[model samples]
Target: MQNFLDDNFLLHNDIAEDLFHNYAKSQPIIDYHNHLSPQEVAENKKFENLTQAWLYGDHYKWRAMRANGIDEHYITGQASDKEKFLKWAETVPYTVRNPLYHWTHLELQRYFGITELLSPKTAENIYEQASAQLQAETHSTRDLLQQMNVKVICTTDDPIDSLIHHQTFAQEQSSFQMFPAFRPDKAMQTEQPQVFNTYIDKLAEVSNREISDFQTYLDALKARHDFFATQGCCVSDHGLSHLYADDYTEDEVAQIFQKIRKQELITTEECNKFKSAMLVYFAEWDHEKGWVQQYHVGAFRNTNSRKFNELGADTGWDSIGDFKQGEALVRFLDRLDKENKLAKTILYNLNAVDNDLFAAMTGNFNDGSVVGKIQFGSAWWFHDQLDGMTKQINALSNIGLISRFIGMLTDSRSFLSFPRHEYFRRLLCNIFAEDIQKGLIPNDIPWIGSMIADICYHNAKNYFPFNDSAV
Candidate 1:
């Protein structure tokens, strides 16, 4: 058998090896969606240790450690950073079949040039070595991104954000570009009246507007959307359990907003109507500004109430949800398509059961206004692994045009996560090579390699409105 993680780790054939090494390996990354801290990038922050860089705020490892019977103290509590990382290293050997196993080693190799597999015996030595490198000037946050050849990153931001860090980064003239993606989920979240009203108050303060009715609220949010555009934002993102398409009149939505402002809990139907209206408004605004809008749906977030109360959201309590997505999604898109206000849209589903549903949904609204105008987004959240990625690619290739597809995003908070793009490109080239070996496709290396290159970098360069001058 071949050595583990050698030069051809994921590459399965001669064609696959050639395709990846030559065409896909060196492409610049376009991380279209991620949760990386703009402040860290702006300040060129350097991590004090490997744990701070790797384990801190990374719920992927936290979940794995918890699965390995690691305590909350060792995972996310007051345990020292080195202790936490030691727990993670102890758990690494047990993660043999998990994607975390591959990712952990991939990160260690890519970032620190460590070829030794991590374990309890070697954790201390590996940690000290990697931590020393992290302290170097060449290993700052910005430098890490440049080391991975990241060209553009779009961070998720709320409507009330100051974006001062983005402004600071813009003035620095770095090699990579960072842009903000407007994520206005809180602006329309009317679930808890107190929380909703509090968010509205913050929005009013940020937009410097008086909010009294639905019209004024929309105006304030619109102003922030305009400000985001001025700050070089060309994308919007929303997270939801599913699409909302409840029919309601403007007056009805206005009444619902008034009830929300008064801190009165609205009925479920009223909440849906208000959210549907807000979604339409956001999509229209995105279209008007020539922005790409993304929807990441079907996550049952914070399922464990006790842990959520202790740790809050996005700490790995979320799971894939089996929500009905077909009819309502069609209604939502058809509503915009009929009005001619549909912007370029990307749809990501957490449930793999909806793979074909999402892939087929793109064909319904791809009105030819743009190439792959309605895209089935990359496999997301729990589905970003090998089986998940392959199934998604196969579904899209069968039902839609994978040629026009924009490729992977880290969707990660760690700087070491850029190797996920490398992972995806290698897997993708292998798939094409396997098909060629089976005589399913012609053996046209240059032509197929060009397609691989486009999927790796060129497609995103052409799709996103980051820099018109980018090659």
Candidate 2:
């Protein structure tokens, strides 16, 4: 029987092992999208303990712990860090088939050199060892990223952000690079008039502009976008339940914005129209600046109202949403393509049911201006695990060019999450090897290995304008 997490962990064949070890393993990572803190990296922050480094702000572990009936205190409340970690250790054994099981051990082994499985039995010893290492200078945030061979990290940022951390990081000489990704979701969020106005006020303050009208608001946001470019941002991201493509004129959208500014509640139809207009404006700006625009859609967030009120959003209360994506998605892209304003776009769907729909959609607007310009992004959020990754890859391979595919990202807040890229690479190599064994593909190691290397790193390097000397 195969040993758990052995050298050939996810590699199922001899060819798979060879491809991973030789081609995929050594490629430097370009984590194109993630929620990592730029401040931590800039400061080179070291954790006081394993829990602070692992469990803090990690909703994935919180969700698992909650499933195991862990109390709120141990999960996210006022419990001591050690007590929280102990609870997590007690719950780890029950995570048998979950990806967290594999990820927990992989992180321990890779970062702390601990090969023992985590459980109640080993928790104390493991925690002590890892915590001690975390306190070391070599285990600081920057050092951890270096150890993982991460070449670039693009952190999510609000348009109102000063990007002071990114600026600070840029001044230092480091092997890896960090850049900001402009995420302007709040700029168009009109669901709550008070909240939207508050955000607009912040935007106005940051951009040093007056926002008396919709035109002025756009001017302020555009100024922020320009400032983000100065700080080396070349990517933009959006989080949405689904694409909005409602047909509305500029005058109507302006009036909706005015109502929002006056702290008046707009109807749902107006909200959708405003969002649709904002998306088009953002996409046009991205195209003008030669930036890549990403949309992560189909998430039904904050389902637990009580918990959301107590803990706020992104505390693991979100789930995959079933939304009608086809028509709106097509209309949105078609609108941009028709105007020649479509940026290099990546669409990530949280729901697995739309895997084929998303994969096939990319084909409609390739235009050959760029290779794989309209990409179905890597499996995201709830779909970032083994089964989900495989399904996404299979769908993309069947309908799109997997060779041109930019590969895995952590999409996580933890420094230790870089191991997810390794997991993805191994799975990818194994898939190709299995096809060769089945005589479905040629046994051309050199050719297939090149493709693997591209998917692992090179594709992203070329696709993103990261190496632009002007930046």
Candidate 3:
């Protein structure tokens, strides 16, 4: 049998190997969307141990560990770091068919140069070696990023954020730039009146204005948007259950906002109207500033109230949502396109069933201003694995121009996660190689390899307005 994780780990043929090695592997990553801490980059913090680096804050690992019947103490509970790691080691082999299996070994191999499969017997040595390396200055957060050839990172941030860490990186002229992407999810969360009001208070403090009315609220958010623009932010991201395009008059939205400010409970219809208005307003600002807007839709979050109450959100309690998407999504885009107010947009659906729908939906509004004006985004969240990526790539290739597709993002909270980009590249190159080998396409390696390189790097470099040269 073939050895585990050799140089040709995901490559199945000669052409696939060559394409990945020559074209895809060495391309600098532009992770245009992620949740990495900018503060960690600025401070260049060293991970204290393997667990701190690998386990802590990684809900992906937590989910897998739980699936393997590992206990809470070994995950996010009171166990020591080494104990938690040992538990993870015992769970790794059991994850054989899961994406976690590949991701685990890839991260270990890429970051620590450990080719041996992780198991209970090997965990101690591996942990010692990696933890020792992590303690070194050369393996600090910033150094880790540099070693991985990460060119630019756009961290998801609330509009009210000061972006001080990003400013710090800019002032120092660091090798890699960390720009913030505007995520105004809290701004549109009118259902949680008290929480939203608290957020507004913070926004008011940052903007030096009171938000007593809907117009004032919009003005406050616009001020933050302009502030973000000044900091080289060219992207806006929304994490939504689904697209919202409920019809409402300006007066209705105004009244809704007023009622919310008073902490009154709004009906589902009213909530949708308010959210819809905010979405359009955000899109308008994006268009006005020539920025790209990305929507991550259909996440049914906080499913386990018991777990959510104990651990909070993004702690592995979320799952794919089956919300009705087409009507509202189409209406939203059409509303913007008809008015010539739609920005360069990317749509990501957590539910893979919507892959074809999103692909076709994007086609309806590519109004010739840009080559790929509207894009079906890469597979995200629950769909970032091999099967999901293949489906997304094929769907885009079938119905849209995959040539102009801006590719993968980490969307991870770990410094060690950049290897995921390499994972995607290998999978991508393998697909093209197979297509060429099967006589489905020309036996032209060079032409196909160029396309691979574009998907891996050039497409994103050309698509985003972020200054890569500055980094």
Best by lDDT: 2
lDDT of 1 by residue, 412-450 (tens): 999989999998999999999999999999899999999
lDDT of 2 by residue, 179-289 (tens): 999999989889999999999999989999799998999899899999999998999999999999999999998899889888899999999999999999999999999
Q: Compared with the true structure, what per-residue lDDT tens digits does model 3 show for residues 299-362?
A: 9999999999998988999999999999999899999999999999999989999899999999
Higher-scoring candidate on lDDT, 2 or 3: 2
RMSD, each candidate, Å?
A: 0.8, 1.1, 1.1
Per-residue lDDT, model 2, residue 11, is: 95
Task: Please identify model 1 stretches exceeding 4 Å from their true place.
Answer: 469-471
Provide the overall lDDT of each model, using Cα atoms, as 2-decimal numbers. 0.94, 0.94, 0.91
lDDT (Cα, 0-100) at 83 in candidate 3:
96
Angstrom error of the Cα, residue 368, model 2: value is 1.1
Q: Estimate each model's TM-score.
A: 0.99, 0.99, 0.98
Summing lDDT over every window of 10 consecutive residues in candidate 1, give the lowest-scoring window.
462-471
